[model samples]
Target: MPEVYHLIVNPAAGHGKAPEFVQNHVVPLLHHLGIAFELHETKGVRDAGRIGAEILTTTSFPVKVVIAGGDGTAHEMIEGVLKAERDKKDQALGRWELVILPLGTANALFSSLFPQPPEPPSEPSSLVSYLSDTGPDVLYQLSSLLASLKSTTPARRLPITLTSLESPISPPTEPIQSHIVLSTALHAAILSDSEALRSSYPGLERFKIAADQNLGVFFKADVRLIPPHSGKIKQYDPSVGNWVDPFTFGEDTLSGPFAYFLSTTTTPRLEPSFVISPLLATLPPNPSDPPTMDIIVLRPLRDPAVRSALASRGDEAASETWKSRIRQVMGWAYKGGGHVDLTYPAHRGETEVKGGGEVVVETFRCGGFEWVPTDAEHEPSHIVCADGSLHTIERNGKATVQVMDPGHDNSDDGFWVWA
Candidate 1:
């Protein structure tokens, strides 16, 4: 029998160009290749997941799921995969491989694997800028990519980021899966706030407006960062240009009045241009290695000067310092991913330093992490973003995020992505 394909296309995804692209581009290509496929256009929220679940139940052999939408639609398909796996009591999840059509605002997962994008336009493109500034050019670029794909191409298994929220009385909140990111603090707050303004602002500008609204909002949490590869929990030192051992401080679990805490798996960015975790971009993931994610954390208390300044002045002043530092470091993201290499004077209430300074961002290469929220009552702190979907942690509850892969043992099951 010939290979079969199932497609989930979301018309509302990615500037409303998906439906047209599916009709004009995708269908023709599959037909030309003599492929047998089934296509379903998403009608409402979670429909894609439902459809994907239905597809999973009906199909037995290896099948391809071609999702032509945004990150949200891709998320639904994964959720469907999880649900189907549970319903059928299947241990493996590898039967279905996926191909993204990249028709969403972020298209974050798409940008991660294809970092520089497929074709080099006359003008250089950044994922951040691509999502921020969408136009015919992007469509053309993506079309160029679709045209280049071969039907016989193989899909690679994607490492997963699983997040579980703690609940004492009832069953634990269902763990969320993240192919792209699992974030809290500033980034999560931004995603939550930006959604409300999405109608008014429309486009990436809403995110900027939302950031302005949530600036200086601190999150208090107890963090335990565990490295995927055993040894000491590694912390990047820009001065030495190496991942030095954090164990020298004689501690593992860290307490903080955190300003930002976010983790990414498989992908290196939240946006093509907004390369939040620059370390992952420079250090590529090895297929043979165990699945892992890089975390970018900012805690004001880690800085002696900032801590003293906050006590003497107020959180507002300390916040200003943090905001300035984040802005400075992120600017480097646009250059050559210099943000991860940023350092600051930790003793003088300083935020940014050019050379021979202590690292400002607490970078971690970890297998998993537990975030016990100190300010769960604080709305922003309770918000957790798993692949742009928001979930709230209950009061006194916590969230544990981890990265896992099949690693040849469960290779027959798990999620795979086609570039």
Candidate 2:
């Protein structure tokens, strides 16, 4: 325990329920523990980041920050602290321990850090029910946080990705740091559209609505994957239940009308049940491990059925067919990230095929990647989502992402989380 814990509360999070939760549950618990805390309520967008920077710059090492909101709030605060640390060139900075209280539409980071036990097999259900059924609620998460704080539980360092947009026509934008996810293509489009539905659908249903809207739309781009330091880029092979080289010719680049492209660092699931990158949880990264991100890729052209349909039936019909396939993949993702194991049959005519074929979803562990939109007029392809916030890559612009190593030189510095 530090001198005093700084509580950054996002009042508007969880459909305006965060402040109420803090008052009803968090405050009383802190009082019971005899812990001293200072409360700071966010007034508007990015306020938490401002508050976080202020606290970090004005305080000493080994500070504790209890964030009472969702992934977006946490992202902002981390960005703030990181920026502040970078700016303070003359002084040595200290570690900031984050205690997440999951109070938002999707508590991706919090749920990932403290995952619940696997649920039993069940039939497919609505998005609302699926989200509601999975993961621990605020009360459960709070208790876990309290337990960790009370015990000898050591803090875990967080790995982050530094993303920047490069363009010849326009000036460069500041590099953005993302602790959870950085994505383009379908995932980016869904996040971009979901904000519009936030008012109508306050819960995770908005993401589903956004997914439906963007499912038929394939993004045109060129991707280049970079290998991790002291390691080669490896792709997950469902057949062998292991990783291997993705390309036969040893090329590191891919051309795409990509169906889905998303990379994650900390969290395996974007929502409570949507396990987009299951390996992150199964093979958690160590502080000394080379910096790498887990990427989930889906290309409609890779499927022979989809390719044949595109050549014979044309774009619209092929798109409709692809939508069904995407829905199937999403169903698998909700079922403990079973999508990674999906493979197409070898022969297109094979009706009862089981084992051998190209994998439908490609999973990779790599240092970083770059995405360049093939067409300037392809508006959807230009969108990028870092954490929950959205950004647009200018025409002729490309986005580059690289994972940063969480150094172990000093135990008092860098971001840490109370698991």
List the global CA lDDT of all models: 0.73, 0.80
Candidate whose lDDT is highest: 2
TM-score of each: 0.87, 0.88
Clashing pairs in 2: 95-412
lDDT of 1 by residue, 1-419 (tens): 67877778898887888888777766765686577788898998889889988787778657777888988998888887786776686534556677777787768788776666455433223233433444555554353234224434456667778788886655677768878889898889998999999889877899898887766667877888877853345777776766778731346687877778888877776677777777776765566667778888777666665666699999788877666666665677676566777667645644454455666677888788888888656778788999889998888888888775565565667777765
Which run of 10 residues does model 1 get worst, by summed lDDT? 121-130
Error of 2 at 238 (Å): 1.2
